[model samples]
Target chain A: MLGLSKKDTTFLLVVIFLTLATPILLQPFPESSALAQFNAGYPDLMQRFAIFGIFAIGFNILFGLTGYLSFGHAAFLGVGSYSVVWMYKLLNYNVVPGLVLAIIMSGLFALFIGYISLRRSGIYFSILTLAFAQMSFNLAYSVLTPLTNGETGLQVYNNDPQVLMSEGSPTSPHFFGIVMNEATKVDVGGWQFTFSNGYYFCAIIAIIVFYLSLRIFRSPFGIMLRAIKTNQTRMNYTGLNPRPYTLAAFVISGMYAGLAGGLLAAMDPLAGAERMQWTASGEVVLMTILGGAGTLMGPVLGAGFIKYFENIFSKINDNILHSWFSALPDGLEDFVVFVFHPFIGKGWNLTLGLLFMLVVIFLPGGLIEGGTRIWNAITGKNRKKKREDAAHHPKPTSHVN
Target chain B: MGILEVSNVNKRFGGLQALGNVNLDIAKGTVHAIIGPNGAGKSTLLNCLIGKLIPDTGTVMFNGISVLGRKPYEINQLGISRVFQTPEIFGNLTVFENMLIPCFAKRDGSFRMHALESIAAERDIIEKAEHMLAEVNMSDKRHMTASSLSRGDKRRLEMAMCLVQEPKLLLLDEPTAGMARADTNNTIDLLNQIHDSREITMVIIEHDMHVVFSLAKRITVLAQGTPLVEDTPDNIKGHPKVKEAYLGEAAA
Candidate 1:
């Protein structure tokens, strides 16, 4: 189905089902329960999950497949957001034109940046990309203030000339006449689920890009990228140029970042220089690595994992911690909160850092490898099978004199 | 007329003349061997022909196209493939995938953005890869990782990768540099089969006398970056200049 192998098709179907049903899946805790704070069914956080998921998926194409670590991918994401917002100021609140322009503009940016950055590979290449991204961030923050609105960020204003806006059209970001922020709440007993127009829109785009990434992963171009990563010497002798292949991958991944950035603005209708920061670039790298760099579903899983921690874990303040441990003795409760304080709320980075370290050390292949290990353990499939299989298919022995 | 023509090729490296005043004409459809001792500049001359290094003053032409300053891939596109001393197969990919890359290169030129199409859908390329694997006696190991293959198998796979392109001239750089007696003979037999079956020209640079005499139709004795003599294998075996090249002053 869809020109994919049976295994890939099944994997893709599973991803689609999970993405479409994320609203209910994320709201496992009841509203009245103390654990309700953990529920991520709200439209704002859900939109981030889809948006960042797309961002990491695109980043994986360049970093994972080609083994070219791009440290400035967030530059493309920022460019994507600015394109969409500029479209909103010049065109209308409708997001289609903004999204279209976001993709095209970011592609051009990626082409220029990729052409230059790809000249040097390894750590030097990474530093070059980092430099370019930082340059872009500075430009957006100060020099390009007229376009980016300086520190205030770019937003749709009543005074701006929205050339395509009609009298009765929705004011906020919307597709046609449907407002993006509009949501329908479904309550089952104490549990609440929000199905938002914005989340679903981002979810649909995420699914499409995920499918495209999957196709690229299985395509000949994907194999060529892997070949470049493995051995450039062999590739050249085989009559394949690594430059064009790597550049194409870089542009494609940049476009993915752009699409994701555009989706972020579609949900919020704002563009800021902070989106292009080095930290933002590092976040996608963390997402790809934490999920499993080379695996298809790994990046999305990593994005969700990090976003969940950022939203849910960071909300665990001192009062919340105290409330949870209130049943214990006063002295013990104080000690418990003190121990947990450094890893939650404003210190959530501390927690994320610890987890990232653990994952890197114990699960070097990322969360996907951990999952595979668990699955293999459950199925009783051990490493011994490799030896047995090799034994069974012995290589044809060399002919003797 | 020879298919590969090298004339007045001189390469120097800071007080060292690696290949000085080298010249040769390799005929089409013949297994020609260039035999020399260590530091005789055999590999340097091979590198010059393949565009890995440019000679100070010379023209290295393949079928009349000068390959002096062309990129390695560009030279490869002009129908010249090189197999390294150590097998240079893609270690991370499976053996079958390794075969498919060269086939794709042969059909698609240097670049093609066939990103949306599935690799399995390329039926013709798959067939060609399978046929080539079978020819190399590696059909059973097609699914195995290229790196996991035995040393002999890696060499065979590398040779198969080059042959899949069906290049006009095949350059083998020490095809049996370090091998057991049995594996070396097996490689010789394999090379003999390939030479007998295909209309392909081959140039072999070798340190092994056995490998040199067993397969070469015509032989060039290179001594100190210059061709001392070019003769048939039978004539080369007893040539006084060839003796002096291999044995130094003792043979003279």
Candidate 2:
């Protein structure tokens, strides 16, 4: 309850509504709407959003709460994806089996890497993680080619067995026991909206995972993790050995990443070594930092923001810009095109880099700050009423030990 | 077997000796106070016992088993708990949550890697934490964040944290080192009450003379790196050698 007040609960509900509804709201807009062309309600993009959202949130568990910056979180995610692909190749093409395999593999990998890397924390820890991630990437690209398919990655082919599901070869049909088709569409008032059955499936998984993470943040272990961030020596003197607790936290976060990775593969039966790249791992780090490291919903918001922009910004071209800017004066069109050309085309990465820097500087708390500010603005006028209620509320028992 | 025993312990940092040939034996359910000057090895001795530091030569035995080469958690599992000079409660945790962690330790032992279970539903742990909080008079502040507590209250919460584990021996380093005179007295009273009520052996490192005299049935005085003398409070207070070597020497 220390972390989850009544206000926070309300805030969480709002976030859940927004994320679940965003795809539908963004999908059906007429072409004239400002957000119509920029929308990423497409199956491929939305699935990526939910997957990376989970990844960023998982990384936040260690870095945000414990003040540990791990450069090798990508290793666990990569291991998870590879393990999931193997499960698909060996067992039935069921999402459930894939998920279990991913989690178990990622947890074990984290245990091994975390054991060694935890030996030296701070900068050394970061370096160790980076080294391990690179080692894993290299192995996936070379020695583990049979399983990982080397640089090209493992893709589902006609010869591959499709045991569990009918339509999606190598990807089992139902998710979390839900009939995917039933969960993906809704019809009302002469309007019909259909998203990828897989997208909604991952969305539900993301919600449940997010809830579990929230519970973790409010638990006793969560408290100790925060203490470790503040004063590890103090916790030790209080009869705690932080190493085990920290390791446990690390493993749990890794499992979450594994879950996300398996979901990624399940949504598309394709395992690419490129997804395991250090850059991909670093992407989640940027998302977590850009959104605000420690806040619960920051990662999700950060992930969505980055993914949406990455999808839209890269689609822009000189032709698209010129068509829109044709309505402008001829003289200013050249000046506008000069500035927009780089960002609208191959220079999307620069836009992301600049946005990340600006967010980290201006809104260090990320989307959570916006949420808090909105809450204050809405509730500020009712402060006296709230306090009055608080005063009359049942006092926590005053009995001394 | 002595419940807790330290034999001929020696510790050196560079050329400086922090503890030299020190020996101690503690039985169950007794309060033992360790008094010393600034450069005395009271803290160092404790650190070695808890496996935070390894002495140059010594073996620490807990309940007939040797405890050297084990981590602090391993030692804690053997029922040896420590409290620092500064209260070390998890600042973000509520007082009740601070109690819950040790209860988890007590119920699960040194390590139980059960990844997913409702820990509160653990009946034994719940009872123990509730009981310990009651013992320390902190049940009311159970839901208050540990960081929000006053200095004395923080110390109280830390003590509750250790008590829930039900250790055979509790090592406290300068429990009353920084406090108002009144708070210090309250802490002394609290310790006396806990020591009286529980079957726990205590080795407290205290700079406060009043606190030491109030609870230590047997006081061991140390100066530089050697034990000055081990005796009752009356004898320790009167001993000329102890006064010149520690009390007077330290204050000067």
Candidate 3:
């Protein structure tokens, strides 16, 4: 309906609905239930879901569409965060300027990095990006201490002049008068739902960027990107230069990462050097691959899945484990808890690693492929039945002929 | 005067002289064939024409402009399209997508940012791509992945991809290298039909004499990095230099 085909329109609508209704959907368990710990309706975690979704969606444009595995997206993310915090320090706590500057700064950084990194393809390209990201990380931590504030991170202080701030303005990060931390909590019997302003703000931006990515996926530019991924030799002979196209994609994805970083600081007025670490860069890669690299919904799904597990699964401490298995026989309960100990709580990485391995081995196309397979299996039988029925009762046109 | 002019082209690879002082002129709107036994520098000469190789000392010109040292895309932007020995279509994309890329390249030079516009909105490009696919008889397989197609179908799709751009000059490197007899005949017929239908110039490199005799208007026989003779296909059949190039000196 929005210049998209009927199928793509429907997919986009579904994504929008899911993003908007995440708070209610995530809080499926009631407060009194034993599984209450699994509920992710809280503001902080939900903000992360939307923020990382933007990051992964952008990363997918490069890594997914062009097959350019960038190990340095986290640097853009950090740049975005620092830009927002700098805006807060110089101007007011309003996120708009910071977010705009974040996109511009990250895009500039991406243009510089992408111009050089895109000269080589495949492993060399990946290593070059990795090197650039690490350099940014080290600079932020040590060399750029004057700007980054070194290990202490960049946060607003009382003495710093917020020139835009007035007597009536909100003290913390906000979109104009609307405070990001403000939430309305509702209680219905044992169930509670918290609708946070920050989550919705991130959700709206996430939806917009997601739609943009979807358009890119179906555009002629997207086709060129895929052609680059498949065969550059043919692309050159077809009169298409792969270099400029790849550079554009790199910059675009970098802008996306920067926007995501801006959103991170908007929710909490803090910019940490740790955000640009290699591990942070690696996380986005995992999210894209785990969910589905090229599919429209895969990166978002992957981002949500990893964030949910990271938050809920890591909170499963020994006490919770003991309480869940307390009803069992004493000896058997201890043994069960012991067996599951390494896979939960502090050992969540082990579980994540094992899941990543399984996804790679059995479902190389990622979670989206698995979903498509299951969907096909359900509808395939009905299609076969319909075909048999049609065979049994041939059309009257055949008899007339 | 001809559309393509190659003069005094010399190429050396370390101790080996791949191409040695070669020269040729290819007329417009004609099917010219370059034929030789293995290692006779047929491929090397074709590479020089398409900017894949830079000859040590030579001038390769298309229409009045020199083509030496230009990038492959730049060479193509000057209205020259190349079909590789093995069909070099984007194997990961659909046959229809394969056609759209060349059409986009033709319409929008080398690079463009049409990221926001939907593919369906490009009505003229779509219509042209569809028309080309229909002309190649690959409309039914348009949605099929390019890699899944049979070898003959893949070759046809690759040709369609090139033809959709409507290049003034078309270069084919071994158009039928390892095809079955039936598929080879089909490809020959397709090439003949394409040549008859368009004002395009074609330069084909072939080891198969049957294909050369059927399609080529003029034939150039190369033996050991130099052209032995350039004549009509009928004259080339009786040329003893051509016989020696293919069957060796003992047979001649």
| lDDT against true structure, model 1 | 0.92
lDDT per residue as tens, model 2, B58-151: 8888887888788777777788788888887777657777777777666655444443344444567678888888888888888877777889
* Angstrom error at residue B26, model 1: 0.4
Query: i-RMS values of the candidates, in order?
Result: 2.6, 5.8, 5.8
Give the alpha-carbon lDDT of every model. 0.92, 0.77, 0.92
**Ranking of models by DockQ:** 1, 3, 2
Model 2 achieves a DockQ score of 0.23
> B21-73 in candidate 1: lDDT tens per residue?
88899999999999988899999999999998989998888898999889999
Clashing residue pairs for model 3: none
- Model 2 Cα lDDT, one tens digit per residue, A1-401: 32455765786678678768866766775445654677566777888888988898888888878877888888888777777677666655566877888999999999998999999888898899899888988888899898788988886655766555455442343554554333355555544456677777788788777877776776656766776775665565455678887898888888888888888777766777777678877888888877778878888878888887888888888878887888899879878988888776678888998887776666666766657767987979647765765643333311110
lDDT of 2 at A303: 89
Evaluate model 3: give its lDDT: 0.92
Give candidate 1 regions above 4 Å deviation: A383-401
RMSD of 1: 4.0
Q: Candidate 3's residue-wise lDDT over A275-368, tens digit each?
A: 9999999999999999988888889889988998899899998889999999999999999999999999989989999999888778777899
CA shift at B225, candidate 3, in angstroms?
Answer: 0.7
For model 3, the stretches where C-alpha displacement exceeds 4 angstroms are A381-401
lDDT of 3 by residue, B104-220 (tens): 999999999999989999999999999999998989888877877889999999999888888899999999999999999999999999999996899999999999999999988
Tell how far residue B128 is off in model 2, in angstroms: 4.7
